[model samples]
Target chain A: MRRRTPAESPSKLSDVARLAGVSLSTVSNVLNHPTRVAASTRTRVEAAISELGFTPNRNARALVVGTTDSIGLVVFDLKNSLFVDIARGAQRRARGRGYSLQVGSSDSDVEQQAEHLRFFDAAQVSGLILAPMHDAPESVDRLRSHGRPVVIVNHDPAEANVCRVLVDNEQAGFLAVRHLIECGARRLGIVAGRRDLQPVELRVEGAHRAARESAVPVEVVEYPVDGLEPEYGDRMGSRLAALDRDERPDAVLAVTDMLAMTIISRLTAQGIRVPDDIRVMGCDHNTAAWGGAIPLSSVSLRGEALGEHAVDLLLDEIDDPAGHVHETITIGPSLHIRESTVGRPTATPPA
Target chain B: MRRRTPAESPSKLSDVARLAGVSLSTVSNVLNHPTRVAASTRTRVEAAISELGFTPNRNARALVVGTTDSIGLVVFDLKNSLFVDIARGAQRRARGRGYSLQVGSSDSDVEQQAEHLRFFDAAQVSGLILAPMHDAPESVDRLRSHGRPVVIVNHDPAEANVCRVLVDNEQAGFLAVRHLIECGARRLGIVAGRRDLQPVELRVEGAHRAARESAVPVEVVEYPVDGLEPEYGDRMGSRLAALDRDERPDAVLAVTDMLAMTIISRLTAQGIRVPDDIRVMGCDHNTAAWGGAIPLSSVSLRGEALGEHAVDLLLDEIDDPAGHVHETITIGPSLHIRESTVGRPTATPPA
Candidate 1:
């Protein structure tokens, strides 16, 4: 630390006024409303600020206000590709709204997710968005009663009237199954993510609807896995193979592309040709599903839109907590059809 | 914005001072330095604050010291997987240091990067870390001339004597080729990322060194594709197969694991098997790479460690700007040899 000279010992408005060649009242005006000061005067006062290397004590400022200026984002699993996109969307939207986002991974642990909220609350963040692994009843109550704007992302819980930003996971499942039926797939299987999320349950319901609507026998087999990883896909592929000849689904629909990619790879290991033998499809047009023998056809959720909407809702809540309303916005899982879903034995030319 | 009620305004310090039966300075001390004031007085002061929703203006505090409690991180390309990993690493590291990171993507344009820099400077970010796309000499000079702490993340211009955080990409390239050679991969083809990055050039150099050292008749073919997307992998696969069995290399080295996954998929489509028809490998053990028909042996660059080290270096620079210390830490591409490189080729399994 630099030693302070006797001249710098006044330690108040009068000392700063003397150093900046301005009156104490002018210094007060500069601190309160900088736009009211002249450019030349502003430059001089700013120079004095840099030379002194002073830090206006936040503790003193905190005496007047309750908290600071930052935002927190809580994601359940860092290991999932879906959350990577969600985090990106949130970061971009938060940047535009004039607050920095602090991201943390829960790794599907309820305790870790709650811990993040407590840490952010202690630091006094402006707002928060959490994608919980399970329905966090106690934690949700604490956050809501704590008097801050909190928007839930990707997943909906058992709570009443909380703000949510999510995509139509059911529509994604419907689209995948409908495409498989078009490809002459008489039977289908599913590689799913964690069952606790609302999207997971909703998607399965949509796929069941498509199968019943088509009057075909659909084999809904859940890949026995913990979190959504590639290993789950590999396990799901073998599950399909182990079934009876009539029970083996001609098409397998994954809740996530990561799972689909794994199923495709492992299925290929067992000498099954995609589409020609059994067609495998997935949701989330993640990069991993593409660039293969037959690029997997899947759904694309508008990531940036989900992020932008979350920010907009949070800002509205912060501006007027009582008068502001809570709402839910469900975006898309737009289809990006590729070669994997086409049920045909082909000798197509390489591009 | 909501209108403040008369009841909320009464919790002001002057009102609190009158209500608590104390002076204005005493109320201020109770808020600023709780220990300095009497506990009885502090309780009265705290009761008054909770009644009011007063948020102290950070701008007012910054006017006195000219410092914002945030850091700036501007990356070259948001679409690139490597850059995304770097940004995540930087953000994680920056958070541990109690600093919020402000991120911006330049989209491979020098003008946009500079514009982002100017905006960040005006916003008064505490410091900046940039991966500049276009070398804006004037802008770089101006940013450096200012007292803000700056560190360039990826690219080194050499003249600036700036702080940097990077891995030895060229050595990684050389090692990939050497590993292939050790496993009897004589014929070689390389798929590289954008040439603008110094790592690409370095990797090619490493490949050349290994071929030179082994004295094996190493024939190399370079595919200069667009950004390191999986599409590039698909395109490269056919190019490799277009050659006669004698001309086609027995191995393929992709700059990224994403590309490697695509290459394996496309090769399988063409009825050519991995490790049997050709050994496939890549850099960066990204999770998706492992989901393929064959597991690619990859050079794992410990992303979390890279993040932690960069923050340490940046903080050191911030603490002692005039120390003239140059510390260049070289990390690794630790090779993970898996199924794609050495396993026996099995029959193509079902999809």
Candidate 2:
């Protein structure tokens, strides 16, 4: 029984004006900005607006007076706490401005990322904050075509042309490796995330650079498995321990705290003493790393500051579309040393 | 410098119908159900809609027929993986039934929950799926007054008036303890979540019941710091190790798998050998627990099933109000013994 009673008709502005006993301009002023209208007339117009249930038509009105009180955020891997922290920061900033966020995750899939872009396009979001993976340059171009403001995160192009917020990964990696070296570690192993990822590349590059500069010939090995996490760390730790004493690396560096914790757990379980025998270090000083079984020694990638800056960049882009400048803002990679990387540096053999 | 424009001469259905070269009924059908209309006719009607930007007056329309397309989900902790999994399940199922879910987190704050309720009220969502922390039965009663549907998750008092989804916490607790006892664990510890929470209470009760039934006296220690997480587990583990050897429990059963992993990590780093010195167990076999880490023995709670059932309950309440029943569906807490709980039943107690 799908029957159509005539679609409900909204009260005309004329009706509202007539009911308010005012000129049409006065009614318009009241709807647009009541503060500009006289108090007595404003009261009448308000009464009429309440009576009519008029939430001024956004499409028609926005064209004349461009404003939509919404913000959009596109992220990679909503499951990741890093992204969640960024989203939380963005949400706080957005809410402070009396705006709400439309959040969507790409789940690390390019297709999914594009789909979210399309949805936000149709939604006509006022601003977009994206943390694109792998193919960011191509996605940036598509985002520009939508005629909406966009700010990128976790990416800083070697030759930049976009607003970005990120941590200094190369420095973070150097700090992590240098810490192990300072603690008397020489034979080193690093469990890096997908090598193709910029953070991993930068960190590894920095670690090797540090090795080249240092007198001790640091034998650095890439412990590559499927992902950057504890599970793979466990596997790597077990294999590393199986090596006869001299063959095993003196220390290991994990690209992420998650990997660091995993390696520590596995190595400890296998009767390999931490710091006393082998040192462990990592980047990303997330609370979970501190909160978990072993408080990991890590280079704190100040995610909150990055997040706050990302929001600031988005708001800047939103305020002035023709601002004519795009750049990446990098925050801290302060080192936090804990039980994992404690002992002094040891002699290392050349790789 | 905003000026009043004569509200574009009232365009009626007749004007749109004539312009689209379609009958009024055709336009009505296109608006109500585009699927029922021919593609060409639907395109024509859409063109007309764009030309006029005709918005059916919602206020007048509401007076005649009340319905909104959105569904609402109220959860206490959206940041939690357990809740996130449940949210994803709910969103997928709701979207399948042609409804979009508007999600809000209570943050375990009653005030925040009420504020979100107000937003949902304004949005006029068709149904609600609540993971409520406070007195929600009263809130549910208030929401029902608006003729909207509500379903509670993991709550009690499941009557024909409401629908709920819960995990068998008692069974989960019982199985975990039973497995430890079967493994010849002479002393046991239950590391649970927030003590005030209903789920925690039920799980602890189950553990108590199992210990009693087994005729083995078990010592239970409750740690109510923040929530059930890795950090809390680590704190608990470290504290347990610090206790007198005779007073310390042989095995620990974490309320959740994340807690279990944390406990494992903490004890290992502290030079305490798991299984040999202190066995550990946890509930909820999440991917994080299973991936790459030790194969943890856990009580698997059917989160996905609960999600699927929540949707069914919501849709039923929405489709046929009279036929809708408020009831709770309890799912499994099957025990899975892993390396953590290694001792067989009848093992001698340590002195």
Strongest candidate by TM-score:
2
Model 1 per-residue lDDT tens digits across residues B1-351: 234553343223345555677654455456434696778888877776555543223333333444335566677755555555665676565554445455556656664466557655665656777777644556666776787767666555665566666677777888888999988987888888777767667777787787878867777787777887778888888777677888888988888888888888788778676777789888766765554555577777655445545555665556456653545555665677777788633566423
Q: After superposing candidate 1, which stretches have Cα over 4 Å from the reference?
A: A1-70, A137-147, A191-193, A215-233, A286-295, A343-351, B1-166, B176-196, B211-331, B334-346, B349-351
Docking class of 2: incorrect
- How many pairs in model 1 have backbone atoms within 3 A of each other, for residues 3 or more apart or on separate chains, i.e. clashes? 11
Please provide, for model 2 over B121-190, each residue's C-alpha lDDT reduced to its tens digit, 9 standing for 90 to 100. Answer: 5556687888887447667888889887888876664345677778888898888888888777677788
Model 2 TM-score?
0.59
Each prediction's Cα lDDT score? 0.66, 0.66
Superposed Cα RMSD, model 2: 17.8
Binned by DockQ into CAPRI classes (incorrect, acceptable, medium, high), candidate 1 is incorrect
For candidate 1 chain B, the 10 contiguous residues with the lowest summed lDDT are B54-63
Q: What is the per-residue lDDT of model 1 for residues A235-344, given as tens digits with 9 covering 90 to 100?
A: 87787767777777778888877777777777777777776777888787676454344457788776655666676567556645765557777776787676567742
Query: What DockQ values do the models have?
Result: 0.07, 0.04
Residue A235 error, candidate 2, Å: 7.3
